[model samples]
Target: MPVTAVDTDTDDLTMTLVGDFPAPAGRLWRAFTDPRQLERFWGPPGWPATFTQFDFTVGGRARYEMTSPHGEKSRGAWEFLRIDPENGFEVLDGFVDEEGNLTDELPTMRMTFAFTDTAEGSRLTNTTYFESAEALEQVVAMGAVEGSTMALDQLTAVLSDLRAYAEGKGTRTELISDQHVRITRLIDGPRELVWRAHTEPELMRQWMLGPDGWRMTVCEMDASPGGRYRFAWAPEEGVAGEPFGFDGETLLAERPRRMVTTEHMTDTDYPSTTNDLSLYEEDGATLITTLIEYPDKETRDAVLATGMTDGMEASYARMERVLLG
Candidate 1:
């Protein structure tokens, strides 16, 4: 995937993706709309995806999984913000934890994809928005630009595949599918106290899950790389509710501020996925930086079909009340 640089340094690194996929407009359109067809060829280099559920409509929701070669899996989702008939669509995306919960500690983005017809091919343009340019830059530094291109290139291949399968396609068209998770709690607490409230599990449990039926089942601290421990969460009630359970193994753990883990769920037949959570505390608040690393950029993308962004926002709204109380 060739990533062309865009010069708008709004947050960290923000870019408007412009490219030409030399396929029919409908073919490209379907590649962006249909989930089943998307699973066929909807990722960067090595990651492959499986769509769990996809609903493409205003305020509709969807979910998907991207599995790495190492048997690792990353999940993502989106909420349809706006959908134009044949021009473009916008959505929010994020990493969803097991038990069907999107973490409050992650950020989400609004991504708009527009298509235009050209003589040789179809023009595809992507615009992404964040609360701040720094937020955009952090993720870009973590590898957003390349990831976007990889997904686009995957779309190109999927469209070509649609052309070939047009015998199966009847016509030349296929379908595909595919948050700012920022914590804005102008809480009234000193920096150290707020930091403690986040780092300490007791305080975390009080605010993290709110009064809902969500609770941490088990939490162990080795606090170092190669450390073995598990962090499990489940709903308080709704026995048949989301996230039957998810277990994470320690990968990187930095005391007083950061931790990284390899997360796997008890249900959902998928492999382990990596999650990096960093804590940045200042005079009166803390900024948690979470990086969910996939086998590659593509898988982080495939699961992005689900609407995890809004979930995070709602969950954090719940978190704020608990934290303030």
Candidate 2:
């Protein structure tokens, strides 16, 4: 997703800026609510921000300062008026002195943020109501519009990194034998969520790709004994690799506990294999273990030589993020 242009609307008493983010509302909400994440993208480029105080709740107060490379600092504060997680919030924003006190000489505005769900992702509509027309003019003349646009552009990058970090965590693989490969990971979420991520097609697609620019274009599952499933991936444009696809039949599906399937790589020279996936809760985390058994030693060696284990590790890391999110 790209950083969209900020739309501005001005009148006698208010200045409204609207923008869209190609991320889920829940993720965007966390960025706004979490101070560590907020400070990373709160200021324009080249002016890093530091949060001195952040209490993200109704009637709470927040204080921060943005410093330029030349050592110039601009302080600000927010008195939160209302907060609705993943939806919207309202705050009284104003300039503060270096001592963390609101400055009387600067203008103050009431800002409301509304998050709407869209097909593309989330739409953030920010409306700032000034005390007077002169107040609006003063802030605009001080580069409020330009500064906000740049800050939100920074937010786009921060959100991307957040997603990547969530999708790139602890994952490992081991070659137990020529006919078996074992992959293990400790996911940082509940076992139920992890189980759903494995069984549901909607959740499966989010993290089941081989590599970047590749997507699971097809995902179908029947979580019952004797049921079948199919998954296929389409490579990015201009990529030379052939499409990858597979079909499997479920031999066991114990919700939130274990699953067993016989899988066949379609349109390939490989033979069918059996996959045993089991999950358990350990110390408030879920431990996922997958064991793949090949038809022969040669077939397992050939698949391993193709570097499929690395891709599987990447995909599992992505699955961790999906479960966390």
Candidate 3:
């Protein structure tokens, strides 16, 4: 299923998800309300949630950990504002570090979750509010809304399995699908120039979002097997008029072409966005095809729908400039 989100200039943001679940409404409601209930259904089917604290009523708070297969982790928390039985609920969700320090960048604003009766099954609508335009843009780039859709899709199956288990049927294993990304680009420069743009720290920073303080603190790449690399790029703060370096990565080097990397942007609303970039030469130039293979399609589309394509194209243009400069 393709996951999607809204991109508009308004105070209200709404997302709707619908699926046919074998389990009843009450069961689904419990899956979301009870902390123990949530832990059972959170994360991608395999990556379970480790709940610290959870309360379903208004003003309640919950923290969770979703661990990836490679031992990487992404944490998030939500502040409950309302929980109206089986009909609906509302809360604000944002990023949290290992120590749970809420970053100054983003926070849980306000969100309303409504459950409706669909002919086939249930429809879930998640409406959110952001502090401003930039705030909305920030989270959109990080693929927040869409990831939840996949999480919930998995929830649907979880409920199905629970229903089957209740009926003495075997457990469900269809939810273990692998996620990946494919980024195909047509750069204006030659293959060597394209390679240099990504390999050189300063050049990578110019196009990629370098470190926050005009620094490339972690852009090391041996470009070989058994080699590891981490790339960081962000715009410097307090600059009168400077482009921001927003997205960066820590990559597992597979050399000369492919690598598994993590893209980190400040939104922190979602856990993590993993990417696999495959580079090759086409007609003397480079065709860098990147497979973003996100853990979920919703996260993929959420970030893609947010003009990420435009920004990345622009970033590539910047790479061209860096090469020419």
User: What lDDT, from 0 to 1, does candidate 3 have?
Assistant: 0.57
- In candidate 3, stretches whose alpha carbon ends up further than 4 angstroms from where it belongs are 1-23, 45-47, 161-325
Give candidate 1's whole-model lDDT.
0.58
Tens digits of lDDT, candidate 2, 1-325: 1335544445547777777888887778888888867876688644556788998879999999886523468999999999887898999999999787888888988999888878988887788988877788788889988788767765664566432433335565666556767666777778998899888988898888877778788999997878899999988898658788999898866587667788898777667888877675644667676778887888888777887867877787787666575
Candidate topping TM-score: 2
Deviation from native of the Cα of residue 248 in model 3, angstroms: 28
Q: Residue 120 of model 1: what lDDT?
A: 80
Which 10 residues in a row give candidate 3 its minimum summed lDDT?
A: 166-175
- Of candidate 2, the 10-residue stretch with the lowest lDDT total is 161-170
Predicted candidate 3 versus true structure: per-residue lDDT over 122-232, tens digit per residue: 555566777776777776677665556556654653454322332222111122234543345656456666766766666675666422244444556544434445655
Identify the superior model by lDDT, candidate 1 or candidate 2: 2
Q: Write candidate 1's Cα lDDT for 1-325 as tens digits.
A: 3233444557543467787877766677787788866764455433456678788989987787765533467777888999997888988876687644676665677878888888987787777777676677666776666665665555543565322322121111112221111112223334455555545666655655523566767655444566565555677666445554556666544354445667676656666666555443433434443445555445555544543443444444555456654
Q: For candidate 2, what's the RMSD?
A: 18.6
Question: Per-residue lDDT for 114 in model 3?
Answer: 70
What do the candidate models score in CA lDDT, each in turn? 0.58, 0.77, 0.57
Q: Model 1: which ten-residue window has the lowest total lDDT?
A: 171-180
